[model samples]
Target: MPRTEVPPVLVTGATGRVGRVVVDLLMDAGVPVRAVTHRSEAAATLPADVEVVTGDLTVPESLDAGLRGAGAVFLVWTVPPATAPAVVERLAVSTRRVVFLSSPHRTPHPFFRQPNPMAVLHADIERLIAAAGLETTVIRPGMFASNAMFWWATAIRADGVVRWPYGAAETAPVDERDVAAVAALALCQDEHAGGDYVLTGPESLSQAEQVSIIGDVVGRRIAFEELSPDEFRRETEGSWPRPVVDMLLAAWGATMGRPAFVTSTVLDVLGSAPRSFRQFVADHATVFIDPTPSR
Candidate 1:
């Protein structure tokens, strides 16, 4: 008998942080991958074996080429929620399974219970998937460890002091690679259909402690200076979006007195411990270190 051929898995947001990793994992597992990107030039960064197609989530019709003959889809929704219904409808007709990258908003933890537009978007997409009757698995990851690089890398590189709010607030920062691995597993295996997994890191660490860990990795002393929420808002008024700043402030304020919500879903799904915050920092130390400094 001839060998069975696996249908390609379509990956949206193929150039994104988590989606890029998912594409690599699927390719490494000998699974065919079809990556959808808005910019044609972005496809050049993906592995040579991937079938890259141009698609925009906002315009649902653009996804037809990428969705054709795909068995499963890894959906990463970062765009606005205007065209989600049409997109979900298209996916229902095009693919058999979908793995959605979501947040742990449904978790009974104060950190995740804040007023978040992103959570609202995720919930709405989940409902859309359920109504469309597509085989789906939702991967909810809490506080990505890579957020440290986005939140503090520039400040750490500029000076040894990180001026930020909620230094005492604790969170278990899940590794993006772990999230991508679980997503890849769900996309490839039929057993994960309808599975909902909330992924977190191995341990909880406060904002200050996380900064200290980065300092340890860089072999220097970095100071954590807590800022008032209003001060933070003023500092980021022009540069950051108003809603995002408010969302972070609300979450941090709500979880100030409590430990972060931690889960073993990564270990349960991948059969290995989730990467620690220190490990994440150690691996990306160059981002936090400046090469040239004035005396």
Candidate 2:
């Protein structure tokens, strides 16, 4: 288990919120990268030097070329549960290590302990990885800071106001960039094998406090208005899946008046502090600024 130059690593979901960044980090480290995506168009966005291959995780057979000669694989199981075994088996046959993006189901934190179906899926995948005898590492990232783009960006961009449910509901929003960085290291290094890292921001902040921090970073005096859970539900009913909406409502309601769970795992693994929500906002402030306003 000593460090050595690894063969090309296959990055599934390479065009995803975190996978693209993982690909970038791997390329930066001079680690060979084979970016896996289902669509040929996604290849255009990745670094030209990377070996872009079309592979669907749900269909294990499609991954043969991408997984060939790969020393490790970054696995993100975004599909349904039925095909997971075949995929993991193919991965086990092709690579010695796998770094899986999973949920913090075992963290004992109320924010992450909700009875969510995705958590169940993640658990099943983790079990598969272990059973397949792949040297595995599980990365459990809490609420992603990028969620603001969906949760509040439109309102913030239009009117500097974030109106949503449970204004004081607390949770640490970890940065996806940090998640990718940790994943890149884990994918390339043997030291992180058989590890379970529950990643989170350095500090906890409530929904309202997070909005305020974004406002500060964006140089705007934004306002946070508490909304009824019903309002949020009604607004997102058609867009988000019912189970997801239910999980969110349950999690936020449970965390009302309580601080989110914070962990030192990011710093412990990376030897540096995880990016704060403030820093995340500052870096992506443009996304909060309106481009077109009502005339």
Candidate 3:
């Protein structure tokens, strides 16, 4: 297949957290962007300069339209039926490069050895992208800093206590913005072709340490209380998907006695240190604040 002549980059999952950030970074770099959302309603948030398209990966015809006239594509499999040969084939024939947002599978640590169905699906996509002859960049990010917001923001906002299992478990949480920047760089430049980048934050910190950082950023005294494994499971029983909950608990349990691996890839690629957990909380402090303060 010939190169796509730098028409525009197609960003699937454009309305999602990392995708929106990627779109912004690409636009900042003056690269024309074609943003693809699953529904027309989701397109409203995209900037007016972006060309928004409604596309679904489950249906091949839907993806073909979005794949047209694009130099490269950022593939993020957010929906189910994770193995889609037609979608990969369409991208292979229509585009020059593909950057996949994937997870770590072959990490030497036992924590990453937890059985995760998502990893299986991402591996399948990586194989298909390689076999299809498209230049591929596979990015495997460690635990996301945003996960803290989802896990503890509510409790901290309400009662100043972050309740969770394995508070001593360590992780090097990567910022979503850093991940987006790397993805945009891979999409717009050829230097990262056929590269498998393992992205992580600068330092390894325990869960309790992360909570304290957030508290410092938010200007409040928040406490971290370790929950029993069974209690934690019960708390998230109906709130999260069964497989995801199981995988997280298993990973956290395995990490209890070990330290998380840290890397400087963000600094190497973006020429700056990855944003610390405190910075993330400071940037998003308003999200944890109640609009109507209770007396």
The candidate maximizing TM-score is 1
Q: Model 3 off-target regions past 4 Å? A: 1-5
Writing each residue's lDDT as its tens digit, candidate 1 over 105-186 gives 8999999999999999999999999999999999999999999999999999998899999999999998899999999999
Global Cα lDDT for candidate 1: 0.94
Stretches > 4 Å off in candidate 2? 1-5, 293-295
Per-residue lDDT of 1-295 in model 2, one digit per residue for the tens? 9887669999998999999999999999999999999989878898888889999877789999988899999998888899899998898998899999997888776777778999999999999999999999999999999998778998898888787898888889999999999999999789999889999998889888899888888788899887798888888888888888889999899887788989998899999999999999989988998777578
- Model 3 residue 194 distance off true place after TM-score fit, in angstroms: 0.9
lDDT: the better of candidates 1 and 2: 1
Better of 2 and 3 by lDDT: 2
Q: lDDT per prediction? A: 0.94, 0.90, 0.87
Model 2 TM-score, 2 decimals:
0.96
How many angstroms is residue 255 displaced in model 2 relative to the true structure, after the best TM-score fit?
1.3
| Cα misplacement distance, residue 19 of candidate 2 (Å) | 0.7
| Residue-by-residue lDDT tens digits, candidate 3, 43-65 | 78999888898898877788777
- Count of clashes in candidate 3: 0
Give the top-scoring candidate (lDDT). 1
Clashing pairs in 3: none
Per-candidate TM-scores read 0.98, 0.96, 0.95
